[model samples]
Target chain A: MIAPLLHVTGLSKRFGGFVALNDVSLQVAPGERLGLIGPNGSGKSTLVNCMSGTLVNDRGRVQFDGRVLDGLPPHRRAYLGLARSFQLPRPFSSLSVRDNMRIPLLYTAAVRAGRQRAENEIRERTEELLRVVGLIDKADARPIDLTQVDMRKLELARAMAADPKLLIADEAMAGLSNAEVDDILGLLMRLNAQGISIILIEHIMKAVMAFSQRLVVLVSGNKIADGAPSEVIRNDHVVRAYLGQ
Target chain B: MTSATAVENPGRKVQAQIGTPMFAALATGVAVLFYVALALIGNEYLYFSGYVVLQFVVMATAWNILGGYCGYVNFGSAAFFAMGAYSTVCIYSIGTEYARSGVGKILGAIPPPVLVPLLIAFAGIIAGLVGLGMGYLTLRLRGVFFSIATLALSVVLQTLVVNWDFVGGSRGAYVIRPNEFPLLPGGFIAYLFVLMLLLVVVALTLARGIERSRLGFGFTAIRDDELAAEAAGVPTLRLKLIATTVSGALMGMAGASFPYYIGYLQPNSAFGLEYAVNAIAMPMVGGTQSWVGPLVGALLLGSFQQWATVTISSVLNLLIVGLVLIFFVIVAPNGIVGLVREWRRKRVLRKAVRP
Candidate 1:
């Protein structure tokens, strides 16, 4: 019942008259872990993009930490402690692993927080982020040299570099092994425990169920359910429209 | 395996690979030889041809900024170059007239030698500004559409220049007689070889700097995939504009020296498809993966073009470029130098593995 750290009211986005997200609304409390589940093409990414300021919504507003995020660009949003890890890990392939970690902190976190971390400080922080993602071994390696799991880890680590209050992880666990899913799930939980809110968008139900404190489902751009993970998973409409399928 | 491990830095390695002591000596030797030839020959034809090739190298290396590293194919390179060339001419033209009036003696007292870098800087800035404008207009389009839009912009700019008589549109404007410096390839050609040399250094340095920086990482990612880059906090539109603008400006600076070098400024020649082709070719021939490829491609192909035109003709130069381009695409899509380096690396790996 406490005030939500993030609030979305009457959110709507349309692509050339095709509604990608229609009247979608959800909220998350500070440091709460949330899972956003949906069928294929069910506005998950559109919603993420809208909130992250990658795309501007036509109607409604997203309020993060009490600031209206209607016109802010993604970097500015990141400066306000918003971060996102892509579905397909998109690290800077040409740069070394350490430099990839250096970007967000150098460009956003250090600048915004007015915490003038020195070169060695940034380097140490980059090393720490890489270590958390189990990628310290490939610290000097290029993204092109990384395997799929490593790329995903780099992507998550990159988002984490922003020192964000909320991390929108879109399909972070997709196309991973069973063990890899658990590994990512554990990371997300650890991140949540560190007072970082997460909106996990994934197809893997087990990881979602295991990680999410609150669950939300989207069916054809509409928010169908937003409540306790157990209650939302057992909802009849969700099963009929999404889960059973 | 150490060398087999993919290089964390892309363009730097290309530069490092080419920056060997022997290669640098050879390149430096060739450049000195060309300058010597131009200085001693005093032949108008040879100097003019040398000037043309030098200009082409400048343009090609400049164009590589966007087309090669950022993966945005800019066909409207001439717009900025022509703008650049014209700006310098206008500024020089105005300065000479101002010098003639009551202000002449007072201005003459100042160190006139400062004009060279001033003009070069002004030319680069003007072109960069033009590039900024064009980037804003055409950066939204990608692939062939982007190329076409930029080309169309060049055409529009060409027409605009053709109408503006102050910039010496179709009639061609001539600046006051330049100082008769004895630096081989008299007048503008000498100035241009020096300009070309400076540009090569600038392009190489800028390319290497960006390729190793955070901006460079963001750029390659955007080139790889836009949506994915955006999701990862790489600002796409802003980066593309900066790339295209800087790319445009460098070409513009290259263009800025053209009026003095050619001694005649015309819209058609300044804003031609030849510039477009040369720009695209340099990066491709050089191996767009690294900045060195463009310089290497420029030196090799540029020297070959110079030799061909002298031994054969200008048409033959085009034929060589066309053939070489086709050959590179088929035999080695990464370009000649890249292919050679790859071959050498594989050979080394194989040799080391022998038990």
Candidate 2:
């Protein structure tokens, strides 16, 4: 489909004889908001790990921007404009909010620039990223001082610091009030509108409905459906098994 | 650039650094002179206290590389110190024999005073290589697992040396002090304090650079959450290895100088739990989150233990360390530096409000 931005073919994985993913094939176009939804133990996280190069897939072709990514590490993938936020937000607790964002921004951005960006440039950009995530007021605060929502915002901000073209926000809005969830949903939408492709894996139906332009449903690590959000929700097995319709 | 701007106006912010460069410089100069004056006073009590305090500074600063910034507590630091001390012993003993050999005759032109630097460099290099090797293995494991593996390696190394008679086994080995000639009887107390001073500076520079650099933040990320660090694009494995290796090398340097200070080296002294505990306690009482924490911990707690050991007793020194550590953990978890920082911020805010 219009020369896939991220292409996966024959992706297979196992955890000591128990198959986690089996011959999964998928394609992601550039600047697409793709929602990957599934029930518990559906290997969503594992698939994400494989795609992000945290756990190497046993057999697969993970092609991003015409280059094969088989043995590259997660940081390398991040350097290549692929970033992800953890299901549980992880900010370096020892660093201030600004310093935490500065980590990826300095490393990846400097490398991409092919020369050391001045210290001032790094600081300015880090503050700008923090501002974008609405964490400027708490820039000097430690992660421990942050509420859960702020922690998640920091996580997203850290991912954004890499200036990724593709982002996988894994359960970013989990365990938030409806209003909080909507708040994060708006942030994700704003990021999406800025020409970044976002793959959101979440359980919140309201968010899944609101954010996704295309949806992929997984049941027990197998793709159950892949189509528009409206039509995919109409599938019989998806409704009875996953959608609870 | 923004850090400069941020510093230009602290703006009622608690995390503001007040004249950071000047503050740190004044602190370092004062600390160095304090130890130097104590050494010059030359009371046996001051000398004895001087010795313990200097070593504690080294051990704590060494351990901070891995434990404080990276958040990986290395219970195995004794191994690095032991390696350095034993290397010094081995080199001294072997050099003595060589002093009698055909090679020794040709080398007689080089004064024995120069040998101290030679032996130190050798021991540091050996320890650093060993550290690099140890890091390759232990750095793969994270958190508790990494600590356990390193702790086990420490035991393994101590056992290995205990059985090896070359550097004196469990019975231990003794070395003549540096510049032992009466004409050049080195003021070892002064030397040690100087060494500690320089090391603290080095460690501070390293810690500060890393704290502000990407690696510094990466270390914090790994400490905060390893999974998140990886997701956040930190090369976690590389960062941990670097921290461990640096930690090990510093421990080695400490060990190398130890033999002359104590006049004897034994496996227990070399690989004892006390050394590891002292290392941890120094940073713990200082506030590991910032570079200043370990420096403060090493200076304050380290000196107190030394003075206590001489004025009170050796066993009493351990008690003081234990009490202080417990007090810090239970009360000010952020340690003395954090407390001082809090106090300073409040004071600064009050000054700003004055009409």
Candidate 3:
């Protein structure tokens, strides 16, 4: 009965001659864990970019929280409660991990709160977020000092600092050990439990299967399947294109 | 997110250490230093040379705001500086003509205190707008392309100034120094030196304020990774424009007093290569990140250049600057401030290990 929190209709993107996303339509209800999986160059990140306003779609529209997001910048989208983590963990190298968390909190969440939050409150929130992500010990350390998994956690924490209604985490668990993957999966699940809707684009099938309640499959810029995770995984085309018979 | 106790943290400690009181104390200390220097220096030549060195401090500090903090390199420092210098010429001509008209004789009597600052403010605004225009045109071009555009902008501005007969053609224009100050103790040169000293303080304070503010955080975010900053809700284009305008305006403010100092300003002298190179090199040699780096760098390099000009040939001043800059870039790319921080960090590590 409720309208979808995020609704994408006929979304298409092109990079000159190559079509990256073609008429990809999808929807996510509030607080839903949506999995988006595609093989390399299958427009998984492209769709995330379009929805996040990093890249503008040539066709179709993205509707978030009942507003049509036609031509907004990434920061504007962030202000409207949309957030994303980069594939390569682009932490502010010069800043401490604490500062990294505080910046996004200040610019997005605090600005969205209309600067009503006190400095103490912001600092407390920053620390709380850091602690939740297990980066409390390394709060004063720079991004360069962080390990691969910590960098990923920091990236996710920075996204969390935005206090987004919808978070599209692009490949957050890539290149991590199985245990590290579980660590991130737990973090994402905790965030989801706190009522933040998430669209996770991941190559790690274990994480995708463990985290995604609803699954969507893309292949060469086309949406192949959209249904329950078990049903989508069992679909003939999805297995042929992605899961490999 | 889980509830956490309000514990003593390094982030809070660092923030507390550098709040309003610290900056206020720094300002007072600098003011006292200048006061003592003013009373001690009786030589006219020392005051004259001191003015130029302080001017560089202002320029370097301003340049670093955009170049160092925001990672936007500007090769058109001369253009902004010249805009200020030329603004002064235009204002001087207009004010002098107005004074000669008998009704404005009263206005001419109040020249030094009233007119100079007004003209300087006007110069700053004009240069700021120009900087905004330049940013609009070229800021979309990343790194080397943006720098090249600024280089081209300097040449274009120089050509326009050379042909503009109103202010001064290629020949030159003379700015007559005012005879006296009503409220101030310093005569003309002394007053100019004092004005420049005040300008240095203002520029440093402004730079420091920006370095500490939300805007400063936004700037570094853009500097580090623009896409990431944008996704984090920093408006990159707007921040870049602000940085460019503020940086350009302060450099223009420093240049506004140039005509009076030089007395005779030609196109080559006003839009010289030295202005562009020194503006960049000082900040680079000092460390681009913080306001202190540029201040320390400008003072060291500026005084050294002054000393070099006096001892060696004037031509060798630039050569020495070139050598120092090249050496610093290769050996200490982060500058003197970075070097000091590294040294201090090593000392702390050694102490920690032993203790």
Highest DockQ scorer: 2
Error of 1 at A224 (Å): 2.0
Which ten contiguous residues of candidate 1 chain A have the minimum total lDDT?
A111-120
- For TM-score, the strongest prediction is 3
Write the residue-wise lDDT of candidate 2 on A1-245 in tens digits: 48888888989899998899888888789999999998999888988999998898999789887889899888878878888998887777766787777677666655655655555676788788888888899988889999999999999998888888899999999999998898889898999889999999999988998899999888877888889999999888788776466
TM-score of each: 0.85, 0.89, 0.94
True contacts kept of 2: 0.65
TM-score quality measure for candidate 2:
0.89
lDDT of 2 by residue, B1-355 (tens): 4466343333122444444464457657876777657646655456555566666777787788788777888888888889988888887766666777875554444554556556666777888888788889877777799889988989999999999887899999888765334331236545654565665565565566566555666777788878777766778888877887777777787777778777888899889778878888888999877777887788798777666665889777767788889999999988888899789978988999994
DockQ order of candidates, best first?
2, 3, 1
Give candidate 3 misplaced runs (Cα > 4 Å). A243-245, B1-29, B96-110, B179-186
Estimate the Cα RMSD of every predicted model relative to the unseen true structure.
Answer: 5.1, 3.8, 3.6
Candidate 3: tens digits of C-alpha lDDT, residues B1-355: 1112112112233544454345656786886688567757666787778889998998999899999999999999989999999999877766566777764475466656677887788889999999899989999998999999999999999899889887888988888887675554456777778878888878887787777767888898999999999999998999999999999999898899999888989989889888898999999999998888999999999999898888888888877888999999999999999999889989999999999
Best by lDDT: 3
TM-score, chain A, per candidate? Answer: 0.97, 0.96, 0.97
Residue A22, model 1: Cα distance from true site in angstroms: 2.2
Q: Which portions of model 2 miss their true places by more than 4 Å?
A: A243-245, B1-32, B39-45, B100-110, B178-189, B343-355
lDDT-better candidate, 1 vs 2:
2
